[model samples]
Target chain A: MRFSIQQPALLHMLQVVSKAVAVRTPKQVLTGILLEADDNTLTTTAYDLELGIQDTIHSDDTNQLDVSTPGSIVLPARYLSEVIRKLPSDNVSISVNNNYMTSIQCGQVEFHLHGIDAEEFPKLPEFQSDTQIQLQSELLNDFIRSTTFAASNSEVRPILTGTHIQYTDGTLNFTATDGLRLATRSTTFDDADTHNWTAIIPSKSLSELSRLLPDNDTVIDVQLTDSHSLFVIGETYFYTRLIDGTYPDTSRIIPKVQRTEIRVNVKSIASAIDRAALIARDRDNHMVRLEVQGQKMTFSSSSPEIGNVSESVEASQKEGDDFQIAFNAKYVLDALAVFDNTDVLIRFNGSNQPFTIQQVDGDVGLQLISPVLMR
Target chain B: MRFSIQQPALLHMLQVVSKAVAVRTPKQVLTGILLEADDNTLTTTAYDLELGIQDTIHSDDTNQLDVSTPGSIVLPARYLSEVIRKLPSDNVSISVNNNYMTSIQCGQVEFHLHGIDAEEFPKLPEFQSDTQIQLQSELLNDFIRSTTFAASNSEVRPILTGTHIQYTDGTLNFTATDGLRLATRSTTFDDADTHNWTAIIPSKSLSELSRLLPDNDTVIDVQLTDSHSLFVIGETYFYTRLIDGTYPDTSRIIPKVQRTEIRVNVKSIASAIDRAALIARDRDNHMVRLEVQGQKMTFSSSSPEIGNVSESVEASQKEGDDFQIAFNAKYVLDALAVFDNTDVLIRFNGSNQPFTIQQVDGDVGLQLISPVLMR
Candidate 1:
């Protein structure tokens, strides 16, 4: 491959695809990024068998890129990144010899790298399904942020490490749980087709996709196959393998009846729980107790070796009977952090049952945490 | 002890002293910070046997602090810092009961901590020497930044891990080396005393002191004793134990005669060396070769597994014979980073002898690096 491109443009494309490069893998080709120059576009692709990212840059009126030949080569991602970043000039020229030795030149600096043949690199799986769903990048980003944190980090049950995503009618639902805690978010998106689909996407992949998604109203097209899913945003394509097992149904676990409910400012309760957590963190479960009486709620935690902490915040509204519950302080803090609303309504079914937290003003999302048994 | 102090003021004092708190130490009291409340000032101290830091807050015009009773206690540093940081109100009240159970109250929040008696905490050593040297904080900070990186990180020779400092007449010299490279910085300070003194201070302590020193010209008093050194900056006192060993003389390592001299732009050559280092870094020695001929200098490095890289930059002036030498790229980069000059003069004694780098216009500091013998 022989081509000359703007240093900044090439660097940006390399960084985007580098996210999928395999680190310390036995297969050396997986650690490389494939560069192909054809027609008026230069495409860069990186795949690690499980995840793949590809981006393309075009040579247009700006005259930032010039292609002298149509060819392809795979170069080590790490060294290529470093070389491109440290190149001295704005314009960089790259060429590959028949022996797969690549040369990169910019002004007075030149780097000759041993490149592997493009044939040795793995190709990204092609999506064969014609069915495609289009949604706003901002909505997808919010869904990932709201529910992914609740996914299981352990590999005991591999399916639990993924976020369950489903689309029925015009509603898109996202749910994740690690047995002790659950987070669910639902949103309405206009779609003409009535087809429904459900898939389990690894929380790790969802996080990377969220980082690449724009926060604005830009539309992104998503295609899902039986084993793989693909996301296309602008000129970039991201693909990830689907988890192989069925996700457990979590609807039954959410409490349907409430014995007590309280509405409190999110910041106030979050700060109180944070302070209590300082003591609770010394314990195994990071357990803290919450008691609701009249219009006040008190959060307390104690460690046999570190003393105790008690903090109270006034609730804006209270209903039903006064109650007490003990749960992990870290769970409540994580649930509270994803809320953009100032006030949240917390509902309790019983001292031992799971309690749910939801936005007081909107029905955007809900978080449920199971109480820990205390002697 | 009972006191009400502004949360911000107390937090600041805790942060300053907490730097000396021991982590994972066998002695329990070493992990706590000693808090002593007297007349109108609340003093906080933390000691890790080798280093100690103390700071005080007074109840004066701002009235941000109020002392109800005079007492002392030791509390865990990590937990106290977290609790104070998350407290809800500006004014926080702290008191201790006869049982050493301490209560921290702010607004509707309360934290009860098990405190240790102040007697268990190690006291900071008092400086017995009346002799003191006063210098500008900015100058001292610069001297530290110029020389400390050359200090040995390996404990094989414990004395090499400390920076040797000497004061004679009005000149203050700071020097550090790890056998392969040496850095020395000297400054002229106005001192009336004719007495000369030399001491070796641990590089870790110097690094911490550098972080605390202000960049502006503020006079700081430093006292050196037989076993300890005390630095008084405003209302804070920092103490560190002197390394109990004789420091090796490094004056003989700096070559006095030169076979080749070249003056080049620091930024241009630094950038070239940085790029060459990318290839050199794959090798054990991180060796990069530099060749100077006429007014141009070229930097190159090659690895059998990763190919090679070559970069050239123009030199403004060159004299003597043309030469080629190989050295660790990291050492040169670290030495070059400490220079504020736009251009540096490099002098070489021979291909095997050590070379020196200094500012082209001024002689504030000098760096000597030994070349690696290549087969």
Candidate 2:
């Protein structure tokens, strides 16, 4: 294979597909990226058995690409990336010899890298489906960010480590729960088809796709099957295998009735809890307690070995009954971070039950956290 | 002790002394910072047995320090620093109870921290010498930066892990070597006394002192005794124990004749070597060869498992016979970093002898590296 491509364009495509390169895979060939240059285009692909990515860069009127011969080769991802980053010119010329050794020349510097035969690389699994869903890249990225953090990271419960997605009534919904905390985020999509489907995607795959999403409001096509899912954005095709299991029913866990409701500025309460949490670090649960009475709210935590710390912040309004509850400081902080509004409403059913946190005026994004029992 | 101090001022003093606090010491009290608030001054001190630092902040015309009672107490350095960083007010109020428990209050937030008795803290050693040296903080910092990288980090040769300092004939000199490479930097101080002395300061201490030095050119007092060296700047007093041993005679190791000398642009050569070094990482010595013939220089490195890489750059001038030499790329890169001149002159005796790297115009700073033997 012989080809000359622009450095920036090639670098971007390499970065997009490089995420699928396995760190330490049983198959040694999976550590390299397959590159094929044919008919005024270069295609790059990487697969690690569970996840695969393929991106194509076409040489058109605006870009310059010259291909004298069409062939394929697999080069080590790390070495190729580092060499491209250190090249001295704007354009890179690469050619492969009969022995499968590739020569890369740019300005005054040249590198010869040993490459594996492209035929030895495993082929990417084919994904097909009759129903396709359309989503704005920004909105899909937002849904992943809001719910994925609540997913369990342990391998004991494999189903809980994936984000559950469903389509109903022209709305796309996402939910994730770790048995202790549940988060749900949804957005209306009028362009979605009438066919309803559900798939549990590993949280790790969704995060990587979110990072590769473009910064504009372009619409992308998504296809979900029983065994895999595919996301098509421009010339890039990202695919990940579906986690085969049933997610627990989390709708029954959200609180229905509240005995007390308090509205406080998000920044004010978050900072107050942060200070109290410092003293609570030496404790068993890292718990911080909140007491709401009249127009005042006080946050405090203590350790018998050290000492106690307390601070008070003003509450906008309070209803129902005055109450005190203890909670894991990190859970409360994580729930408070998703809201863009200045104030958030936290509802409590009792001192020992689960509570709900959401935006002060909207119910679209809701988070439920189970309170800790104080001794 | 009861006093109110500005938050930034207190934080600065705490950060300076905290560096001397031991992480895990047999003397548990050494982990706490001793605090003494007198009529118009607040003093903070920390000692790790080998190193001690004391800084004083006086309530003079420009700074405000209020002391209602004169007393002293010791508080855990880490906890105190963290609490002071998270306080909510601009001024911090601190008071000690009869039982030595300390209360810290800032605005609406308050913390009670456990404290140790101040009487158990170790006292700093006093150094009194008639001969004193004055150095500009910037100049001293430059000297430390140029030589410290050559110090050996192994404990087997403890003497090579320290920088040798000598004051003779109105000039101060510094030298450090790790057997493979040597670096020396010096400056002439016209006000120096006739008394001559030599001492080896641990590289760790010089690094810490360099960090505390002011950015501007401020004159600081320095005193060296048989056991310790003291550096006094403004209100801060820093002391470090001297390393006791005999340093090797490195002067004889430098070659006296040059068979070939080449001058090349520093940036061009450094970047070329950096690129070549990437391919040389798999080798045992990480060796890169420089072949200088006439006006052109070529840098190349290769491994049998990985392929080869080569690059060429122009040299301004070359004298004597053409030569090819191999050396550790990292050592050559490090020596090139200390020169401010656009071009550096490299002098070589032969392919097997040591080479010297320095600015083309001056001899005050010099670095020598021994070449690697090729098969």
User: Candidate 2's residue-wise lDDT over B65-155, tens digit each?
Assistant: 7888888999989888888887764888899986788888877778888888999998887889865788889888888888888888899
lDDT, residue A181, model 2: 85
Pairs that collide in candidate 1 are none
Q: Model 1 segments beyond 4 Å from truth?
A: A61-63, B61-63
**Can you write out model 2's per-residue Cα lDDT over A1-375, one digit (the tens) per residue?**
999987777788789999999889777789988999998999999988788899998896444777889999998888888888887648789889867899988888889989889999998777667877888898888888888888899989999999999887777789988877888988766764458888999989998899888867888789877899999988999989989988788888887889988888888888888888888874457799988887688899887656678888888988888888998898878877877658888888878899988887765488888888887
Candidate 1 CAPRI classification by DockQ: high
List, for all models, the DockQ compared with the true complex. Answer: 0.82, 0.65
Candidate lDDT values, in order: 0.90, 0.86
TM-score of 1: 0.98
Q: Candidate 1 chain B: worst 10 consecutive residues by lDDT?
A: B187-196
Model 2 earns a TM-score of 0.95
C-alpha displacement of B145 in model 2, angstroms? 1.0
Least well predicted 10-residue stretch by lDDT in candidate 1 chain A: A187-196
Q: Once superposed on the true structure, which residue ranges of model 2 sit more than 4 Å away at CA? A: A60-63, A192-194, A362-364, B60-64, B192-194, B362-364
